[model samples]
Target: MKKMNIKKILVGTAAGAVMLGSMAIPVLAAKPANDVLVKNWFVYNRSSDFAKLWDDNKATVLDNGGVGFTFNNVGATTWYTAYLKAHYNGDLTGKTITANVSVTEDNATFVTRGDGSTSTVGIVIKSAEGNWGVNDYWWPTNRQLLSALGTDVDIIASTSDSNRANWINICGLPATDATIHSGPDCVGGTYPAESPYDGFTNALKNVKEVGLSFGGSGYARGVALTGGTASFQLNSFTVAE
Candidate 1:
């Protein structure tokens, strides 16, 4: 696959939520009209050279104003990441971030390796503690999250196999007890202590950006991307106060 360079452009803030394809991002003067502040994002796949796939056509805005992307030959170790900076200048310590995410497979099938383990997807939020530096906290699948939380959640049974759109909520951030509050339809959990940004309280206070990634590691290699294709979409991303 061809490696693409991801670009970032800071635009002015508009009156309403900025869709993926509409006008450029408006400046963040004050709090947004809605409870959740949304920003334009750029999505890319991890390249062989450990780079982000920059083909603009692969990641595009849908007619409904949502963001979408197509993945091909996504290796077991391969993963996709969507980068979006926070346009809200206010403190997100007590705020909650939520999104409606969906993934569909088109002629796509995973290449089973050892144990026929499947892949999972989830979100991550990073803070700007070191002056826009990296302090990221990952929220993997529910089973994974529960396991990290010292729960008896079954990892193998935690694979997200459906193509349904589910709302995921990451709440109580910037707090020591921050948690992933997604419903049964969705699978997610808070950042584990092993994460670089495990300090959720500190990280949430200075959140600068958020990421969405797919694939699994550890027991097996990862999600193998052989021949089929997968499309991912984020219907909405909101930060509630």
Candidate 2:
């Protein structure tokens, strides 16, 4: 793996001081009121007000240019999802997003004792058709990393107006599973509807937010992780072109 040089930029705000990292350049002045790309990132731990987790010390900035979190006793009814939205008001048509993501189980209990179908970690891109009424989402399929020792993958998504969105797996080894196979080769199905936004490309055309998410529906089906820890990391997320 190549070494990543991530810079941390701290700015003062009415709420206090905020830390922004991995930006192209550091802004020494006061923070802007609307920094869609860097600010307003919150962790949703099975609740609508997941943003509160930021202040609770649940999310932390890793030393290696990434964000990390630990979940304990998380049930099927609840999961973790984190996102950062762009502050711009224009459409994201013809744009692409890329990132290096990794997820690992600190212990083997979940793999050895569980059915191996109960966990998932992935990248998600969300977009709204118009002003922000209904939204659509795109992400990688669970089979892409279900049975692997951990996740270390590079994912790319390109957007278009129609169902022309594309998700490519640049490199990395992902585990495969037999069940939950209903979508593209490595990409997952689009949410709400699958007809027009069958692939990730169409969903990306109007992207409003993007981020990483961990958790699966397998727990609801009786598969549980009684012991072990899982960590999800995003080295960086940037506009591809």
Candidate 3:
């Protein structure tokens, strides 16, 4: 009976240890279901005030090439910018992503400064920035989109200028949303009527997220005062998932 009692006590202790260990394992290894997932779109439209600065640079960037404009006093200068707010379901810290930006302008103009007399002479994505600038004329000084994503503007093609008839496609992951601006006014003096692309799209390849900036600056590029005059429009934007 004494031996049987000792054996029974040992068995009970072993069972208790096993049960405790099982409970602790789950507590230590379990993770919440909402730990990883991102969902949110940061979109900016031409209508948004972000495009205001483009109006100033219209002269040098766009109109400088001898484009036409509705606002005569609008020198050949225009400035344009964009912003996006994406809701990463999870933490976006240390994630690699690629964004494809498409821009179109209507009734726009262009002035070829460098490489004088080039077919497609117009504003290029100087760099992507996180925040909006004071006006389209001023370049974004903080949190540059290119510096963040570690890439530069990759211009696939550009069609038309100084009118609503130009198309631009670029690929890269800006550290954050992109603020694209262009104008022809490096020589000072204010220009007005900076128009943005009719539509804009932002895509994150790593997480598979896409956002459309339609109503505000819409997902469109802006027009400058370069020359030429016509209603600028952006075609539907497409991105590979």
As for model 2, its CA RMSD to the true structure in angstroms is 11.2
Q: Evaluate residue 94 in candidate 2 and report its C-alpha lDDT on the 0 to 100 scale.
A: 60
For 82-185, candidate 3 gives per-residue lDDT tens digits of 32323332211222222322222234443222221211211222212443222221111111121112111222222112222232223221223233444543
**Which scores better on TM-score, 1 or 3?**
1
Candidate 3, which ten residues in sequence have the lowest lDDT sum?
6-15
Per TM-score, the best of the predicted structures is 2
Residue 139's lDDT in candidate 3: 15
lDDT of 2 at 89: 34
Candidate 2: tens digits of C-alpha lDDT, residues 1-241:
8554322211221222123322221112334222433444445443323423332233454332344444433355433333322223334456555655554554523321123445554555556534331125555443234336344366555453332423321111111211222334312322233233332334444556566544443211111234665544444555533
Model 3 misplaced regions, further than 4 Å: 1-73, 76-108, 112-223
Q: Give a tens-digit lDDT track for model 1, residues 140-178.
A: 333232112111111111112131112121322322233
- TM for every model, in the order presented, reads 0.48, 0.49, 0.22
Deviation in angstroms for 226 in model 3? 3.5
After superposing candidate 1 on the true structure, give the runs of residues whose Cα lies further than 4 Å from its correct spot. 1-39, 49-58, 74-90, 110-117, 129-135, 140-198, 218-224
Q: How close to the true structure is residue 17 of candidate 1, measured as C-alpha lDDT? A: 34
